[model samples]
Every structure is written in C-alpha cells, then in structure tokens.
Target: MKKLFFVGILAALFVGTTNVSAMTEADLRKKFDETVTINGNKYAVSDGDKKLADDYLAKYEVSSDDCDYIAKKIDEAKAILTAEGQEDLTKLSESTKTKLKKLVSDVSANTSVKGTVTSGSVVILNSDGSTFAEVTSLVKQTGTERSNIAIIAGVAFVITLVGACLVVKQVKNSNN
Candidate 1:
C-alpha cells in the first residue's frame, strides 16, 4: 500500500509538472485585446483616431472556420480605401497605412488560420499555423525555467564539490 501511494504521488508530480499548451478562444481574444489596449495606451491618440483604430481592429474576430475571411476583409477594406483615389484616404497616416498593408500581406500568405493572430492588430499570422502569442509566450517561459534549472544545478554542484573537499581535508588532518 505504501509503495502504491508513493507511485501515485510520483505520477501526480509528473502529471502536474508537464507543460500544457491548452488555450481557449476566449483566452486568445483576451490576449488580442490586451495587446491592442497596450498599443493604444503606448501612443497618444485623439478620440477620432482611437475610434478609427477601434473600428478597424474590431472588424477582425478570430474565426476557426478555415474560410478565406481575412483575405475577403482585407480586400473589402482596400476597395473602400482606394475606391475613388488614394488622395481621399490621406487622413490615414503613412505609418498606419504601411502597418495595415504589411498586416494584409502577412494574412494573405496563410491559406488557413489554424490559430488566432498575435501582437499585430487583429490579423497577424504565424507561419506554422500555431499562435504567435501563445507559442512565443510559452517559449519565453520555458527558456526562463530552463535557465533557472541550470542555475540551481550549478549551485548544487558547487556545494557538493565544496563539501567533498571539506571531507577530504578532514580525513587528511585526522590521518596526520
């Protein structure tokens, strides 16, 4: 019974320590929202600018349907912006236009949206079909954890070496 309990505890510890990549749609949405909020706060925008950005960003709700919804939306936006002439949409700063165009280009490359967009407002694409936000976040966390483990291991090795040296010195002194 005691051996079974020990095995159970070891199993539980292994299970608890395993990395999990479980992410829900709501979690992805929150990450998107937090990113937008951070960017929004990072720069100063007028009410009108904020409203425009909000409206533009709101159009993208991540869908798992695997349809070409992103391409369609980009085309629609482009058509609307360039309908008459480029002059009319001059109010959209060159930087914003460049960013949006880059975003559209990125989204266009991915035929399927396996996971949600990250960092870039609404339509950023991760080439591998895995989520950029979640994957990067996990990678960073794992890197930190690995670094911590390495540091702990180094400290333990040093302590053990020092203790062994002390023991050896004590034996030599006793023999003398």
Candidate 2:
C-alpha cells in the first residue's frame, strides 16, 4: 500500500512539473530564418546568380564538389561587385566575365569547396535527430561563436534538469 501511494504521489508531482510551453517548430523556423538572413547579407551569393548557376549545372555534367566550388566562386565574384559598389548584376560585362572565367579555371585546377561558407538556405527538419543535424551543420558553418553557444545551451539544459530534480526531491521530503 505504501509503495503504491508513493508511486502515485511521485507520478502526480512529475506530471505537475511538466513544462506546458516547450520549443515548437515555429520557434526553430524563426531562428533558421534569422540565421539565414544574417549569413546571406554577410556572405551569400545573390539569389538570381544562384539560380543561374543551378540552371547552368542542370544542363551540364558537374561533380558535387565542382558545383560547390563554382557556387563559391560565383559568390566571390558577387562580393567583389558589391565591394566595387555594383549591387546589380543584370548583365555580365566583358571584363567581369573574363575575371570570372579566370577564377573558374583557377578553381577547377585545384580543390573543391570544403568549409562552411555561411551562404546557404535555412533547413529545418521534422525529427529531433534531423533537427540536431541541421543545428550541428549550422554551428559548423557559423564557426566557433555558435559552437560556444551550443555548449552553453547544453550546460544550461543540464542545470535546469538537475534543478528540477532537486525541487521534486525537496517537495517529496517536505510532504514526508
């Protein structure tokens, strides 16, 4: 009888302590949007140029790594244009095309894209594992700052869990 009563009380206490407002898909999406926005302004290629590159690859034989390299080069070209006070890239001038051609040829002779360039779309997944993978990828792309944030978040979660357990134990002790 005592064991059953104790179990019942424990279940009740746990149920009462359950958080009603936990993280939702919307929250994750919001964060994704923010991250993508910030990264895009910082290092991403223009959407129009990205589309053109994608279309070009659709009709060409290209390795994944080569495609990534090409995309990176395209973004670099866009960065140069932005730096030169040329925001619009409606038409590629002969000089610009010549420069980009040289870049492409140079890149083709070397390695493919490897590091996280912080110049991609935001991806959110339905499953927890997939979401975690996306978060890991994002952290990698964002570099050390986000990695530190992830570590701190993990520590805070552990602390919160431990604090909750202690509170439950204290409540049970008080009841006794």
Candidate 3:
C-alpha cells in the first residue's frame, strides 16, 4: 500500500514539473509576524519563509497561474500538517499530494536556482533540500543530485551556537 502511494506521488511530481516550467511570477513577500487575527488571536508569518519565497521566485520566471497554484499548495500543505497532527508527511489527500509533488519537481527542475523555500515550520524544497511531503516522492527518482542538507545542517548548528552564546551573554548581563 505504501509503495503504491509513493508511486502515485512520484507520478504527480513529474507531472507538476512538466506543467510548471511556463509559470509567471507572483508577490509572495511578507514581513516578520505579518498576520491576521483569528478568533481574537494574531497569526504570524515567518520572515525566513518569506525570504525563501522571494529568493526562489526571483530565480525563476513563474507564470501567474503557477504562482497561484503554488500559493494554494502552501495552504494545502499546512492543512495536511494540521490534519495529520505533526510530522506525518504521508497524510495528504491524493490530489493535494499530487499537486505538491508537481511543485517540488518544478522547483527541482530549475537547476539554476539551488536553495530552500521555507514558511512557518515547513520545508518547501523536495528535489534538493528537505521536505517531508516531497522526500517520499523523490526518493526513487534517480539522477546526479545536489543536496543542501549538509549546508543547512551546518548553518543550523552555527545558528544554535550563536543563540546559545547570546543567551549566556544575557544571563551574565542580568547577573551583573
């Protein structure tokens, strides 16, 4: 069953890439904490994710239709995450999963652009970077691949060290 599902996903991704090459660009930029109130609570957008969106879009000539399609896929990714209750990358509906794979393959096909597009806690890259939704689909697709995992891991370690050092500095300052 799992194999069948993965096969289906891989098919979707390839289909998306073929179709997405002609897409135009869209405005996906957003400020840190850009939000709308939901049930009297403010829901914020991640600044890093916006930067990812900007970087990817700038590198490619995405058509308006593809742009909208991607934007919609982002929402669907979130809904899948919510419905599956965290880190269950296999929970997307068949159609939604197909669309997501398409976006991944599309992004991956653009060899000129190499990096990740993250939003909130989502890793939006599939061809090179890490995205749970995309990984299962691409695992079987073979080619001389470029991976950003090491770079991302190193950067993450550095960021953690910097954060720790800053926290220590703050603690010392408070003591003094």
Candidate 4:
C-alpha cells in the first residue's frame, strides 16, 4: 500500500512540473494591432509646425517616421504571433496600447535609422553606445504550489526506497 502511494505521488509530481509556454503568438498580434491604431492616430495629427496643409505635410514627416517605427514592431510581432498558430486579435488587452507606446519611445531614442523602404525588413540599428531591446511578451510564471509538488514527490520516493529495503531485510531474517 505504501509503495503504491509513493508511485502515485511520483507520477503526480512529474505531471505537475511540466513547463507550458504561456506567450502565444495570438496575444502578440492583438498587441500589434492596438499599437498601430493608437500610434497611427497620434501620427496623423502631429504637426510640428503650423502652416499651409502642404507645408505641414512636408514638415510633419517626423511623426510619420515615428509611426513607421511603431508599425515595424507591430508587423514583426504579428508575424511571430501568426507563425505560432495564433490568429485571433481579440485577446489583446486595453493596456497593451500604453505598453507598446512606451516600448517604441524607449527603442526609438536609442536606435539610428537603418534601411530604406525597399528593404523587406525595417532594421533599426543601435546607436554606437546604445543597446537594442524589444518588448516581446508578458507571461505569468508557474505557481508555488506546483513547484512544491516536486519536492514532496522526491521525499516520498526516498522514503519508499527505505521502506522496501527494510521489508527485504525482514523477509531474509524470517526465512533464516
């Protein structure tokens, strides 16, 4: 009975310690969409210098540049999200827009403009002293209870082995 209990406990431990990758691509896609929409709106109205519409359009290229940078991040995240078999954008949260803006602002200030519109991928080169970083995904870690299961199972297995050793010794003595 004790042996069976220990085996059951060990089996449960292995089952409980499995690592599940929680950051699905679908979540990234939704975040990308939200970022594009929010940033696009901001870019359209950001006129650096007030003048004629054409003059504003010509001088207003800076906002477009910012928009393009945010767009590239969104596109990259979308591709990864799609390849991971996540097609739904509805799972993205409202807070994702705020998070993406902060990420873009941080990345943009440190990186230099790289590649033309003709390049397949928009590459942002890191400045001479700057490090390039991107916000990928936010995921929750495994719970403490799950981690404890492995320790409990390990102790149970050791106890079971000792019990089996004692039972074998008792049998040998009885037969002698």
lDDT of 4 by residue, 30-101 (tens): 322232122122111111111121232222223334445544554543343333332233233435433433
RMSD score of candidate 2 (Å): 25.9
CA shift at 153, candidate 1, in angstroms?
Answer: 84
Question: For residues 74-162, what per-residue lDDT tens digits would candidate 2 score against the true structure?
Answer: 45654544444432333335565456445534453543311111112222122232321111121235459888999999999999999
- Which pairs of residues collide in candidate 4? 25-81
RMSD of 4: 20.7
Compared with the true structure, what per-residue lDDT tens digits does model 3 show for residues 33-152?
234332343333333333444444444444545445544544554444345342333444556555555555554454322223233122334344544232223335464334567778
Better of 2 and 4 by lDDT: 2
lDDT of each: 0.36, 0.36, 0.41, 0.33
TM-scores, each model vs. reference: 0.22, 0.25, 0.31, 0.28
Write the residue-wise lDDT of candidate 1 on 3-117 in tens digits.
1111111111111111123445454334223211111222122333233333323433333332344534444443433442333232445554554544444444453332332
**Candidate achieving the largest lDDT:** 3
In candidate 1, where is summed lDDT lowest over 10 consecutive residues?
1-10
Residue clash pairs of candidate 1: none
How many clashes (backbone atoms < 3 Å, residues ≥3 apart in a chain or on different chains) does model 3 have? 6
Whole-model lDDT, candidate 3? 0.41
After superposition, which runs of candidate 2 have C-alpha atoms over 4 Å from their true positions?
1-59, 87-98, 107-176
Which residue pairs of candidate 2 clash?
A: none
Order of quality (TM-score): 3, 4, 2, 1
